[model samples]
Target: MTKLPSVSVVILNWNGLNYLQQFLPSVFASTYPNLRIIVGDNASTDSSVEFIRANYPQIEVITNDNNYGFAGGYNKVLDQIDSDYFILLNSDVEVQPQWIQPVIDLMESDAQIATAQPKILSYKEKDKFEHAGAAGGFLDMFGYPFCRGRIFDSVESDNGQYDDVKEIFWASGAALFIKRDKWIEVGGLDADFFAHMEEIDLCWRLKNNGYKVIYCPDSVVYHVGGGTLDSENPFKTYLNFRNNLFLIQKNLSFFHASIIIFIRLWLDLVSLLKFLYDGRPKHARAINKAHTAFLKAIFKTGKKASKISTARFNGTALVNKSIVWQYFVQKKKTFNSL
Candidate 1:
């Protein structure tokens, strides 16, 4: 019998001992043949590494000297591992038993298909899609990221609405499945992003290089969203806003990026004001700080931008309309309506 390609499900952990205790068994339950489960610990002071070593003796543990955050941690750990495919999983996710093979089969069928993500549902709600990566990720004309099962803050119920296999602008970092070669070819996730939208930036680079990012509904995982950083945290807000600008800057042509970033600045100001109106001054200040950081980092990020081939935003899954206008002005709540 021909051996199936090897797959490594590398969970990047940082002070997520509870998550590991909760979800590792579910991940171990995956039925894929020729699989290896690894915990890439990012300098956790919480005895997470010790717990994994003691409890999950079969699982490989790689330790980083310092907390390199998500992007850098994965890059560091992945460098030492060899596999046909790599599933960069979050510690908080619970995988279905048969989650692995379907996606590997889908990816193996095509060389150009570089990255894919499983259908992500909320672990808390069960029936509803998760916020980070609902079904598949898509981008609007203004560079706003959304998902088939989620638009902005509105997450949809999983009624098999997005069961079809489709191309997407980005795959969620929460449970990102990537071809090992493609990952290395694109230089992995940008460490500069630190966290948030780093996967989107990587996906955009893949798209720019003439590769496909796909959503395979056959495999599913339930994500306990915001395990590392809560959604309401101002730091999460800063990363989202700042990294979004970094995403556009590094991917699009200067002319196109200029137009979109110009518009986004105004939209972000409105968001800042809304946060203040809602008595969330910290979040409002996060937006301000994010913009400030973007300005400061432009030159450094610009160097990275030059490395990528600037393709016009004509990818298959890129929506030509602004999701903000579609969701708010037209009151389109669902992905289908848009």
Candidate 2:
């Protein structure tokens, strides 16, 4: 019998007592031997720690002093876990009993595969792919992240078209599986990222370091998207726009970053106008705020990105074309269209 590597499934919770209650059972039922399940509580005021302690006594709980957001919180907790691999699972995800084995098998086959994500379908609409990460995440020429089965808001139905094992530009953080050493080598998630697009930035760094990020469709999970923050929340809007700029600036070449940032600002302006036109001033303001924060961050992040080794892989994994143009101008909604 082959001895499986030690696996730790760490769920970061932030006032998600209900979600944990609803989803923890399925996670507990995971069939992977040599598995350790842990919940890292991000200073929840709602007694989430107490609830987990009482109900799931067998599960390990690590509590942070305050809410360090997603990136920082996970970094703090993951530092203590000395496992072979760590699955940075969202509190809201519901995993199948056998989800861990297939992903582990795939990772074991390729030592260079530093990060991987399973097919993420919607918890509500089980047949449809979810928003955060569908099949696997990829980037456009301009640094927009989209999935193989999801483009912008148009999520494709799961027909197993993307079931093949292959390399991808990024893996979704919703249910990310990463080698413990590889994750530590890249310095884990960038704490500066706070939350949004942090995983993409980490994966980009992993690629720059000559590692692979892949999609393993054999393992699947259901994610209840927007559990911590809803899409309409202005703060979420601000984070998405702001973090996206930081992502590209910190990874791409200076020439590419400058040009793409300029273009993205203009596109953001159009989105702001659209928001105002739709009588949603809050959203418009959020976009405005994101730009302001991004501009302020440019100098600091620009210097840092330049210092990092930019040994990029010339691969077809990245879409050389503009996904925005493909989706809006040509009205190509599905992943197969482009």
Candidate 3:
């Protein structure tokens, strides 16, 4: 029998004591043979480190002095780990006993696959797909990412529509799996992103380097969406808007990036006005801050980190049509529609 490659499952935690207490046991119960479970603590003041050492003494806990957010926190913890594959799991995810095996097998079968994500279902609504990553992640022509089971805020019920394993544009960070060497080679997640869209950025770099990102629906996990940062937080808004601009600038060609960024800025202004009209001043301000930060990011980092030889987009995960127009104007809500 062939020996399984070592898999390191690292869960980044920041003041997630309740989530850890509730969900860590499900991880411990995972049936993978060659697994190393770790809780990389982001300097929680809630004695979460102490609790881990006390109750889950067998599991390794890599504690940082301060909260490095998601991107930096994973970069720090992963540097010390030596493994064939790494699963950057979120603290609030609950896994089944056989969750890791199918994904591992699929990835092992294809060395070209740099990253893969399991089918992410909602922890709250068990029958429906999660917002973070539904069946798999896909990018629109404008670099806006939506999932097979989720378009904008509309999440589809899982009726076995996306059960087939396939290539994807981006794998969700909630339960992201990547090869160790490939992750380090592509500079891992860009620390500048801080949090949101960092995974998509990483996957884009991997794809540029001639590797594929995929979805393995056979392996599934449930995510309690927005565990660290609430979805409604204006700060989340700032990160999404700012980091998406960074994503386009960093990956797409100069001509393509310029066009998309210009269009996105206009769309964002509309979103800001809608927020203000809805009496959400904080969200409006966040969008304004995002635009300012985006300008700074472009000027500060003039060069692309992951430069590719191709002149245009090569990945199958991108939807050439405008998802915004299809959803808003045409009233096509599901992924199958457009």
* Number of clashing pairs per prediction, in order: 0, 0, 0
Instruction: Give per-residue CA lDDT, model 2, range 1-338, as digits (tens).
Output: 88899999999999998999899999999999899999998999997899888998999999999999999999999999999999999999999999999999999998888999999999999999999989999899889999999999999999988889979989999999999999988899988879989999999888888889989999999999899889988889889989999998998888888899999999889999999999989999999998888888878998879876866553537889999999999999988889
Best by lDDT: 1
lDDT of 1 by residue, 148-251 (tens): 99999999999999999999889999999999999999899999899999999999999999899999999989998999899889999999999999999899
Off by over 4 Å in 2: 312-316
Residue 224 of model 3, lDDT score:
94
Q: For model 2, what is the alpha-carbon lDDT of residue 312? A: 59
For every model shown, what is its TM-score relative to the native structure?
0.98, 0.98, 0.97
lDDT minimum window of 10 residues, candidate 1: 305-314
Q: For candidate 1, give the lDDT.
A: 0.93
Task: Compute the lDDT of residue 120 as modeled in candidate 1.
Answer: 97
Error of 3 at 291 (Å): 0.6
Residue 28 alpha-carbon offset, candidate 1, angstroms: 1.2
Clashing residue pairs, backbone N/CA/C < 3 A, model 3: none
| TM-score of predicted structure 1 | 0.98
